[model samples]
Target: MKKKAFKEILKYVRVIVFFAVITILVEAVNYVMVQPGYARYIIHTVDNPDDGSDYDCIVVGASHGRASIDPHYFLEMEYAVNPINMCIQGATVIDNYYMIREACNNNDVKKIILELDYQYWNKNLKRDSDFGDLLVYGQLPFTSLKMEYIVSQLMDKDFRTIYFRRYAFAKNWKTAKKYMAIKKTDEYKNFQIEGVAGIETEGPYQGLGFFYRTKVTDKKGKLNPSPWTYDDLNPKVQKYFQKIVKYCKDNGIELICVTTPIPPSSVVSGAANEADTYFKQICDENNVRYIDGNLIKNEILNVSDDDFSDWEGHMNGELAEQFSEILTEILMKEDNSEYFYSGYDECIEAIKVRGNETKVLKYIRAAVFIAVIAGLVKCIDFAMMPSGYIRYIIHAAGNPGTEEGYDCIILGASHGRSSINPKHMIKSGYAKNPLSLCIPGESVVNSYYILKEACRNNAVKKVVLEMDYQYWTNDEARDSEFGDLFEYVQLPMSKVKLEYIRDELIDKDFRTVYFKKLAYTSDFSKVKYNIKTKLTKEYRDYDISAVKVCDANGPYMGRGFFYRENNNDHKCDFLVQEWTEDDISRKVIKYFQKIVDYCKDNHIEMVCITEPITPTAVVKGPSRDANTFFKDICSNNNVRYIDFTLLKNDVFDITDNDFCDWEGHMYGEAAERFSGIMSEVLANGNEEYFYDSYKAKIDEIERKKS
Candidate 1:
């Protein structure tokens, strides 16, 4: 009996072991099959159509890099250089060091152009922590050590959807069906460049002149460049920067550091000078070559702020092409031996021939292969997944629909999205039909195309653009999700836009996109879904009474309602304050003019209004100054301007406590009161040109309110 029991126990143990092995094998197979394609997508996406390598020269930094360099111009000169811009908005030197390291490992990068701007060395611990260091690693083995980030990448719907859909088995069935619905017209398949340059037109820069500003410094408390120092430079960060240089030198890769030209604003603050000094010192110590474009006043002065979409110091695509031509001439004369690649020229020629012939076939084959795999996968799990949610998500995320009909489309940075209330305008009668075609953190270059696409729908009548102060300053923030907006736009620019975009927007590294997706993917659900719901709830019960209003003199002293002022400076934190009088005035005028031009050209009526603020916090300074500037802009443009800074007594009482978040925006009861005021404005018939049937909608809304 004992022998029989022992034998049975051994048999059970064997069964358990066999099941474990089978599970591991199945998981391994799935991972191996899916991973290679995803990796390939990340690697191949950055390859230049002319040559299958990383960009010939990459610009790595923060916002300066994004605004400064253009890649197409380099391509136009036949320099065999592609600029893979890997700059992150608000990025630090530490962030760049890792990005450069990872990019080198993943691609056959030949040269690196580091944008040594003053801000790059400003290492804010909070900013670094928020940006994280994982984005730099790309597909290197050490990346997985950050397991939390890896899990986040796995959960990101955008990253996963984009990655999987590109795979042979996970293509979106509806998208595939739509493609099939459109009958092919050409007998011969058109060879198209998928890696870059989707459609080409005249570059946007051509005859459009550039405007330059002189850097001025004031003796008062304010400095031209607010803060300019490498105070944030610590030992570890400097070590990493040095490591990048050393790695390139040992690996036979040429490292070229270029300080992109600065605007007068930065020059006034002495930031440009400080940045140049630091880069020079680094290059001297490391035996690397450094190009100081910021120091070249004559060259920089020749190109104005108009040459840049952002009006910051950086050049736009057109200027970038010119700058590249200058740099190419210099480099060619200085040192041809450094750039000599063994068999690279021949390889490039061969790639051009093959790329031209197989471009269309490659895309078609990829699509068909993905379709077959998707069919097989569907057969395996047809009953488990729901289809509508994906489509709903796509639509909610601003996928353009077949229906059209929009007048006075708004475009800009996050300010446009956060400040404008579309529903309020619709109910108030200010607009017959208006669409807020704005996304959070969108730049001017990116907005240009989105506006173009909307206009192409033939439903859009006019465009209203909102500008942010940072958009015209060196402090502009970068979006890691889109890599560099400038670079992405350059690939799609008309021939005119292309000249500058290609020369300036393109960068050296393509792997940064994949790495960024991996790093940010971990919190994909939180970023894409949770914030919307949270923002809605937090704004639901904002109390205006809790807010404190101040003017140029400080807090109000009179008997009009007042809130207690806090001793701490947190009131200014994340609150939009005009840093200087000039920042507020210039930005308002610039964008207001753009709006007027768009409306006049499109034959649409335009209205400019300052949305209501909490009564207790309607103080002066930047915010109030901005409102005043808007009034001036409307007067100049012949557009009707409305200021609702002070709410009416009988309609609805709004106190400072009614604000949902901080002083910058209002919500809860305040939103309702503001919405009521909007309704009144629409009923007044002042905006008759916007809609023919506006009276009916106003009547219906007033009736509902009653």
Candidate 2:
């Protein structure tokens, strides 16, 4: 009887083990068959090719660095150093450290530029700790580690999801199959590798949705820290950060910490200061070379906070160009020769070709893995289906649009569009016929689609691009609603433009909302008061004010003023500020070159014009420098550059009240006088070139008025 009972128990155990094995096998198979689109959230596709040795100096920071640094500018400066801006949005010090580690591990990087802003450190500690630490450990475990970090890693659902998706038996099987298929093809083997690094690194899916929210005392009150202070982060995070420093030191990779620029308002809030202190302390303790651009108050503070996208703290593209140049100067001055790569051009080419192959394989594997996962999930759901119950999961994915047209399209931040008027040329007869497509507060990435559409339709003659100082000074917004503009307009994502989109557009809004929430906590009262105050202030003051009109014939109402005198006699201030002229000139030239290239490719002519500013405003000290930069840019572009900076002589007879409501913009009477001056310039063509049709058009308009 005892033998029979034991046999029964053994038989039951064997049955249970069989079922477990079957379950595991089925799961593995399912993971292997899923499509990559389904699993993209777990694995981000790197759109920009990573030529193994592409970057000698890699910049890692929060949004501040993203907008403030331009690698192309550095390249133009003849520096072999190609900067890979790995500034993620909402990135904290911990996150930055990990990103640096990951970048160092993947590439033969020498110098790491970490933009240290005060906000990075001043924020609640708990809010600062995020998946960046986990990613750092995952990529370079030997460099940075903590047992508590490991525990936190396990607890993070998103982190688990990414890792599991990568290594699951089913996922791996799918990846393997996809790789095999690509291995069979040689077409993608010889892809042309352009050495130009893009602004965006990964696809739209790279970012984990994290947002931070801090409690304010009242709706109108500034950001307060009391509520967030209580949420202390896990102490183990520091240990992990230290480990990263040690790893870099051990690997002989120079760790350079940088703090990207922030707007004055953000700086005044004390966050920028805190971040500087934090990074300074960390770098000092570790003996790492740290550069804090965020603390460079005068240069950075000049940019207005409103210029930032959605009021999030980051500089826009215009600012990035300037900042990148500054960073290049610093690097050059430092003479860290050990960190510079002499054979960067050769490395870029080789990496480009190799990177394409790697990318194709990666995509194929991702597709297969996702398909397998989807299939398994569907099967399980079907098998477990119950009456009147269903599961639905919807995924939104695809290219936002195309990149093809437009010789030139002006991409401006809030104030950029307000500065230039396409109508001025049309009415003045400078352009017999012209199309102006301008978007306000449009990031460089957002303009991709608009330009693409213009290219496709042959609608753009030449782009009159405007760069706000803020555009290049901050991180790209991740979920910018403006991406909808591309989709709605039907912009094509060409290979070249796609590169720009990834580099410039992808990481906008880098901080995932999840991380932001963790960093900020609030009481109901504080939240209410803050909301109320913000709403009232926004409603009362943020919108456009009513337009004021001046009589054109009376008191020179239509004439526009210039902020400075044209001493060069080149009709602009190109020669006045030669010291900082290169900085501004380089950006304008590059921008126009892009336009010129597009035009040359499509047989279109391009011209650039500088709109008029109030002379009183320009001559009054610092404002004169505005035209100094503008004039230099126009001179370098070789386009028909016009500076109304000295137009004050023509408009001096006009009263200040008639010409401008504020110092810059023309209201009622001033607009009309400026329009008339523009008409004469168009008709005469200044002996450089004759526009008969423009003169004819002006005559027709004048006749109609009579």
Candidate 3:
């Protein structure tokens, strides 16, 4: 019996150990994945006071208090209050109560200002699922109170969400890359939030927990108030509010409840009066002050729906400042009834929603109208967008491993597309099957994604990267042009595409991504043509001829090549793009390295090459620097560097006459010949066909031609 009992205990111990390890791993991943955001910043600010000064008053509530309360205003107006705003977005009464406790624990708080939004007091609402709640919970100091809070609030949430906080956020490989980089920083480790706070649409997060919202309501007077009744006051919320009151009383802290101003349109016809009466009676019972901003007449606080950021009545930054000033003035005065109406009915009579917008049918009609408008806008955006070469190339690539996948793929900008012929390479017995995935105006970063796109479908054994010095630029104007946007927009929806967007295009103007027409100036005359073309079966199937215009220089050739007609008599006056160490973009280096690394990881051979350019006047230092830069990169990565400009004139006789223009985009005949030569060299792995130096080749050509 004793031996059996011991064995049972051992079994339980083993199970516990297994779970402990799993729990540790889950927590570790959570630590890394959950980025340092506003919650961490705000909590750190209040919990660990930088000034080491006691706050005279601290505001605790949800987003309304966070945006509306400006503690600096009180200081500026010579009020004897040193305040900290501890309001959080989507914070419930429970969150507020804990925030109050946290503030009081850290510093000597003389008073508490609680902002009330009756919508948050709904009994049916589940607070655990809120990302805001999880963020705050994750940032809270590990204490008995925290444990209790976790048991009360977070126990019912998904274990993944509780342990791996990023589960609550949009989980993607790209977002992981972003946050992983963030995790490596000293700022993140030190819990610093100074430089990185707020988003593009939202204004900056001012210190002391105030968020200045820059966006105003576009809806104007058309607002949907969160309809609430007096009975909607949650029992749990009341319990916490009462706890906050009792805690404040025991600590000898003055408690003042204030309802931050909302647009009159957000106030349901009679709901405001119900909330006002209930809050007033409760505050009166607790012997605390209750001031409702909704009761403030239109004369003193002249605000409309325009002052708000949303229909829910979150004030914009400008309105917050104005309201803060008024709030400070009221706090200074002993009796502030002059600024406010006697009751909610009087306030509603003065400021009300325009027209009969409160009806249910009106709301339904408005929603339907907005939906229709959105759909029409999307249609217009789509119609105005032109079909570019990228769509053709991607479509031509076909699905993964389609029809005995190509072993070789060429990737780069237009030079590769126009110069190298996959057909000629195959004819010369170089590669069994190959595809040129090159795009016009493609950046090094874009080339990496193109390779990824190619590899996903085909069994890629080799990648030939065409180096264009002009495309290796850090300038946002140079890299994120319409061509780049076109390439991104055309890629099929896949993991690779999503990762590319998250990693590369997340920061680009969203309008450009969603509405491709916005990135380029559309010729209004072609609108009818474009819309008609897009509607065709050819366009839908990505027929190259459907979109391609047969210009003088070239016609669209299948397998991602544009066959250019030779212009032997064309003048060459354009300068050769000079490259220097100083001019080298870090973005170019990063993406180039990524390509090299990817090739290595996948066991695919990557060859770096520069296509022949017209030997125009060379800017002395940059020519040599360009050769050195590329050579060093290839050598460091143990890859071959082939500079076609350094090809021996005897081996491949090409001139300015062979190219369509000064950029050295080969005409069809010359391109075919070069492709044959490329195939021979690549098949034989011969370096003797090329000169040792770029400058030497340029000088020899210039000397011979002269």
Candidate 4:
């Protein structure tokens, strides 16, 4: 018995070891392939300073501060403060806290200048910490702080973002090969700033984290600032802000929060006043110094729209020098009120708000700005979303309902999609209107929504629910947040969709919802093609031919069915995944029950059907029990349960050649035959249509064939 138990344990041990080795190998490849970027430069600069000297002040924030403040100017102007700009692009308040801790640990830093970019702290903005953490994590030293950051922030992100940092770049071999070659170089290995900066074409990398861009903003370009409101403060960002304050206070470091100056063109008339009021209120409560560059008088720091590099408020090289000088004076002066206006209104008047625009005109500008942003977001949604059947199914109007109410609708995964054709059922005169809504790899959860969507739009009299046994054993198919995104984006806005978003997508990765491009594997070369196609008449018209002609399957025949041609030489030669009772998912069952309940409540008849499979693919497992489980649920619910796998050999015989592949997805000729047979069985509703069990049916098929 001991020896038998040891052998049993050995089998499990081998499986665990196999997966562990795969995990390690994948991680190792990701580490080698990840392309070095901006994070490496900034982290390396602080880790290995050119002079190897400590600084008196460290500037921490996002790109606005990085380009606005030149630390070298503080030294050149003969100030006692020796400063280094530690402001990283896209750094959040959480990132700021870690950066301060890292800088304080490495050097004798006496003060921290926290640059305030309202975009990071605004409640309404869609900020992604997962993507933000990815930029900083790879360059961090192997210390407790690094481990803590990984545990806190990165643990929730997609593992691909954590390990494969250059996920987007991996699409192009030219880009991938370039990075791989760069990784082998001595400069990259040594963390040399020159070598890192040389690989990309951006602005000149001034030492101490100061980046200088020469390109100036077009004076005619609109410069709209991200909106700010008291109620819109992000609590998580506020928490980290307080942490930074406490960290500075405990260490006897002077902490000043500064909102760097923007071009006059970007300022909405009274926007700065409200922002400054909130900043001062928060600063007073914390006993921290606050400075608003927008409030600075024009005489003290004369900046124009031409001074800015872009409408978003990043400064050109010339503007940075002027701004840095003004920054120095603010540090030097005992009372800096001498150099500034009372508030934003005073500053706008001083700067001359483009032909002295009235309050009504300012509101108009704000309205126009919002409209442009909304339009851009819609364009981005179109560009990023990949063209596929899911998009076609969701967008197409005549999908099993809408035109005329469907007498019956088929819903399931790829197996049902390829096997059953609604046209065949309609031609058999069993139903007036019937269509298939099955999509490839669709889960029960997805099917529920599709049913809801169909019912919401038009009268759906009956729903044919295809029961794929494999989905019950696979958690990914049952409840993958990433998998849901593909359907989620294409779904038309409705109460059902709103509930779907709340229940399914609310806490998932923001990238999955906002960055639609990241949901699937996309070739960068096709981005132009995707954008262009979206603008075409065919796409806007929801022409089925766009997908039918382009689909990998033979063609989309219609009503959510893709007809794959029969391969004469192909044979089904795979085994079904064996599972025990424990392998079944409660979530899958819950959604399955929901579908049944929904149909009943709506006064519609619902039938559960298991599509036939090749006899060779049957295995000794809980498949029998699984089939009986569904049969019991349908029986208890007063819904018809038909396992076509147990259908009489006289009704229909399925051979390995009937299927296109080992997975039992039927080819075109086979699908039509099965569809005709299924129509007859449903029309008759006879108990004599199916055999006693799946095993008995398989045995009968083999006995008859032999």
Clashing pairs in 4: none
> What is candidate 1's lDDT per residue for 1-706, written digit by digit as tens?
9999999999999999997886676544333332222222222334323356455556677656654555454566665455555654455666666556556656677877777765545554444442243333232244533343346433443443322232322245554433332213231113222211201221332211111212222222222343456775655557768877887888887887877765433454355555567778889899888776644433233444345443245555656655656665555557533332133233234334444665688789979976886676544222222121112211222333336555546565443443455556567655555666545445555555455555644466545555443443333345333535323322223453453245323332333321222222243344433234323433223222222222211232111111223233333334545555454334334534554676678776665555555443343224455555556657877987665553333444454455443443443335445545654664484343222232332343345446
Model 3 — which ten-residue stretch has the worst lDDT? 615-624
> Candidates sorted by lDDT, descending order?
3, 4, 1, 2
Error of 1 at 315 (Å): 28
> Which residues of candidate 3, in runs, are more than 4 Å off?
1-374, 399-402, 481-483, 519-521, 550-552, 568-572, 576-578, 617-621
Models sorted by TM-score, best on top: 4, 3, 1, 2
RMSD of 3: 22.0
Q: CA lDDT, every prediction?
A: 0.47, 0.43, 0.76, 0.75
Candidate 3 lDDT over 103-151, as tens digits, reads 7778888888899888777764565455646756777888877887788
For each candidate, how many residue pairs have backbone atoms clashing (under 3 Å)? 60, 98, 2, 0
Which 10 consecutive residues of model 2 have the lowest summed lDDT?
A: 388-397
Model 4 TM-score relative to the real fold: 0.54
Clashes of 1: 60
Candidate 4 lDDT, 128-158, residue by residue in tens: 5556666666777788988888898878788
Would you estimate the TM-scores of all the predictions? 0.34, 0.33, 0.52, 0.54
Candidate 2: segments with Cα more than 4 A from true spot = 1-54, 78-82, 90-98, 117-237, 297-301, 310-312, 335-706
